[model samples]
Target: MLSPRAIAHKILLHIEQESGYPDRLLQSYLDRYDNLDPRDKGLITELVFGVLRWQGRLDSIISRFSSVKLKKINPVVRIILRTAIYQILFLDKIPARAAVNEAVKLARESQPDYVVRFVNAVLRRVSDNIESLKKVDKTNLTASGIAEIYSHPKWIVDAWVKELGTEETAELCRANNKTPPTSIRVNTLLTTSENLAEELRRAGIEVQPCKYAPDALEVKKGHFNLQRLEAYEKGLFQIQDEASQLVAHILTPRPEERILDACAGFGGKTSIFAQLMENSGEIMAVDLSPWKVATLEENLERLKIGIVGTLQTDVRKLNEMNIKPFDRIFLDAPCSGLGVLRRKPDIKWKRRPGDVYRLSLLQRDLLDSLASLLRVGGVLVYATCTLLNIENSEVIESFLQNHPEFCIEPISDTIPWMKVFARGPYFCSFPHRHGTDGFFAARLKRIK
Candidate 1:
């Protein structure tokens, strides 16, 4: 029966100490405390995500207020300060006094008398100077300025500024800082989108038809567990982002086609492919992790999909499997996950500057290896939830230089509705512009 703030404190500590994903950890807590008030659950979610989203700015504020350096402070005490400061600065409904009081109380539980007083004094100072702390200079376009203002790493800001200019980079950072929508794809194999939307509304969840993807819905309102819904148990839909749903459509797998979902992690898009094919195709969903393969199989069963087979093998090792040429191949290669920051803000902190360059090389290798597995005239869609050019189009360019047999195929040619997402021959969706996760995909055809 921990209070919402206490639960948030624990979750944030786990994220800082164990590198746990906020969503999964929060969900686990909520699931265990099913009888907890929905509002309290919402607060817990808000505190954890808000604290992580604005960690950079929060740390800056801490440094300004505390005599002790930010790094020298105890980790637990730092989390207490962060949660209190987040609520004080961001939440209009929460009183600054209540935030400050709760932080002192939390600190007193484990900290010494001097430390508790120190926490109280720091929060009070922040509360008195709250206006100044909340005021952001949007006109500051310098890398360090944007990093501190938008709570992004300086290197990421530098990269975005170098590639996308200051204005768009600021917009991207703003979008990443905001909360992302909860989107799910209709399991057309089990129910129609219209019917599922109706069911969700009847059950008190407000949903809207997704703007681009024909089969996806955005949850406009609802705080309860989606997995507890009868529709979820019945497998009428699968939780997925609108942008991610578009990748399978870009691949456009046909009924009875032999498809290779290379680097398939948990099979969100693979399940959509099965639905589009009316559950008639053979989809070999491959991943390097055994846990992901097991999870994919479980999700496929829950979604009532029967056509996808799970394979626990790396894409680099697939050549030794003697697999026949496939009609379609989907390489949702791993990347820096920069585009999904809105949904997973921890990524902004977890990823290093070198990660983008390192992952781009892996993406290029995945594309090169999968190219030989696709039959002549077959299409292979390479996609990532990332905004960096070095990991997206540049990876494709590097692969094409060595593998002349494959050329970029316009995504719009296969799905004309996707033309709106097109950037040159590639499909690029931005969180700021598209209201979806930042995503990049390029469809390539084996020209023989």
Candidate 2:
């Protein structure tokens, strides 16, 4: 029987060497490996995500004791320490001695003599200070909250500090570190939200209705193998957040009206738009990524949605389609994904704050590019899955100033959950406040 640590080491090594998402990799691992029981599967998940969440602090501990350079350590040894220390600190069930012993075994096999010795010394030292590491010192800036609780970039915290104030930013950081609730949108065309909830319940899954998104349901967390379920294969539901579902709703597509989902990579929102339009209106789903466009087509096929026309072309080069002015266009621009830190914890570590401004410029350009295709009096919903002011409201504000023909139409009480979030009639959702992924949207009408 392969120990859970061995499996975790392999997964972590893949994460470090290859460019793949931890979520997808973990899922694939669980699906492909047959020897794992539910308990072992749970252990592997805890070890992998725990190490990833506390990478910064784990490195600090290694640097404090190890004589060798941090960069020179073998990747295998590093992953061993990551798995061991992760158990020692976060997982209450894993006894400290077992973690150390297994780590030493891994180190000796994969690393040289010098590295193995150093890793042994480091893991022992970390075990001694494990209690101290777990202690919460609210006064210290590098305390557990910012270090372990948020699992976010220090620069992101600093940026949030400037924007959301110290206390509010701390709340935001805490919210991001938590395991996000699994919210899925019911395909209203196939079923109602209440019926879907009942179906999930009958299938031994607990689900609750989302307070915000009318068509969304919050599933019980730590679900195992949702893809294997007949419900998933039949496409009774889609995995999307409440806030994201709201974006398509905000677009408010009427039946028979032509729509363009510009920059619709993989078409999550586009599928929702098709459902809302009752499969009557035409939707041109365009993206720069040809691979993603192909994936989008497959997803549409899986959902049994036939109304969307998937096109693999950059909307920036608008000449690809000899298209007439559309009644509505949904611009779900790409941003730094700051608001979705809970779903993709690695994004916080990977992104620099400066990248937001660069993306803001691109978002503005994309808006202008797509706006040219909208007819006068047509509605255009500009949206982003980001919380940064630079990417959200600021980009829209800049676009409004540059384009005199477009006006920010006041969106008063379109969605009931949005009643409290009236930031000058612009819709913004935050994890801390709205219990949804961070999102921003504004309604604009082209005036003659």
Candidate 3:
């Protein structure tokens, strides 16, 4: 069995070399070593995510200590130093000497003796100046300074500064770097939030009611495997962010209505639609990937929901099928995913400046295609877990400019309690402001 550091090294190397989500890759590796102790698993997770979260700052620090430029270093050696430096600077429990020793040992596996010695020299330098290097001047408001201090790409920092002043952007970056809370929505069909919270607490898991979403609970403290819990096996609740849970409330499908969950990824929101409709409505849950469709079917089955049907086809293809207009539609369109950085830090490194514009085009196409599928007077909620206006309001604005038949339905009037989260006609939640994943949702009504 690979040690936790070894496992982390492999996963981080894969992330650097390939195009895949860190969470998915980490889970696959952990599953292979299921015999690992829970503490070991936890450490593996911490090292992999911590290294990614602080990669930019780590590289900056490495540059200060290494004679070789960061780009010139061997890929594996770079990953080893990154993990060791992450543990040294971030993990208080880990001794700096142990971190440096483990890094040298990891380097010896594949690197030459010279490279191994190089790794030792750099980590030792980092340890020696650890206190001085750790001090990030918050007053340095330049984009590059904020980028290095917060470990975000400079382009992202610049964009955010333009949209939300520098101070707010810094706060947002700070929030994104921290660990996100584990929030779950109670499956009201099976049990109430109170009962589920009681059950979880009885299992020695401390949970508190979510401030906004009535059925959501934040796991304040717990160490047990959530999937192993009886409540989870029974599908009494789903692990969803409180911000995401609020999207279902925006849709608010009624009994016996026909709803279309466009771009439903494993039916996270589709299940909620079934619950709100009290299983009286028919939902055509569509996704582009066949595997995701299969998983959606399984998740619905686990939740004991039967009112929804799954389809595996590009959402744009749905127009070719002879389907009747629906009472409601929820298009959780794909975006750059900047909003959930705390949960998925790899996105900061993976996404580029142009990705937002590229995704906005697709969002527009999906919105236009789904608009024809909604009957006049029906509601369609377009949502994305991204903070970019290009993907959020700009797409909506361009659509409204072209599609005169549809008009923005103010979320404040539709869901008064959400007024605080609303920016005029749109509903948005900021990680820095609302303590939820950065989410944007716009309600539009098809009017003749």
On TM-score, the leading prediction is 1
TM-score, each model? 0.98, 0.93, 0.97
Per-residue CA lDDT of model 2 for 274-375, tens digit only, reads 898888879999998888899889888878888899777778887556889899999999889888877776676677768988998999889988878999
Better of 2 and 3 by TM-score: 3
Model 1 segments beyond 4 Å from truth?
none
Worst 10 residues of 1 by lDDT: 134-143
Write down the TM-score for model 2: 0.93
Per residue, candidate 1 scores C-alpha lDDT tens digits across 264-338 of 898999998898898997999999999889989998999999998888988888888778999999999999999
Best by lDDT: 3
- Give me the runs in candidate 2 sitting further than 4 Å from their true place: 140-149, 411-416
lDDT accuracy of residue 358 in candidate 1: 88
Residue pairs with colliding backbones in model 1 are none
Q: Which window of ten consecutive residues has the lowest lDDT sum in model 2?
A: 140-149
Arrange candidates, best lDDT first. Answer: 3, 1, 2
Question: Model 3: per-residue lDDT, tens digit, 1-448?
Answer: 7779999999999989986878778888887888899899999989988898899999988889999999999889999999999999999899999999888988988888999889999999999999998777789588777898899999999999999988999999999988888898899899998899899999889999999998899999885357668889899989899999997789989989999999999799999999999988799999998888998999898899989988889999989999999999999998999999988898999998888888999999999999899999999999999998999999999999999999998999989999989897899899999999999999999997
TM-score of 1: 0.98
A best-first ranking of the candidates according to their TM-score comes to 1, 3, 2
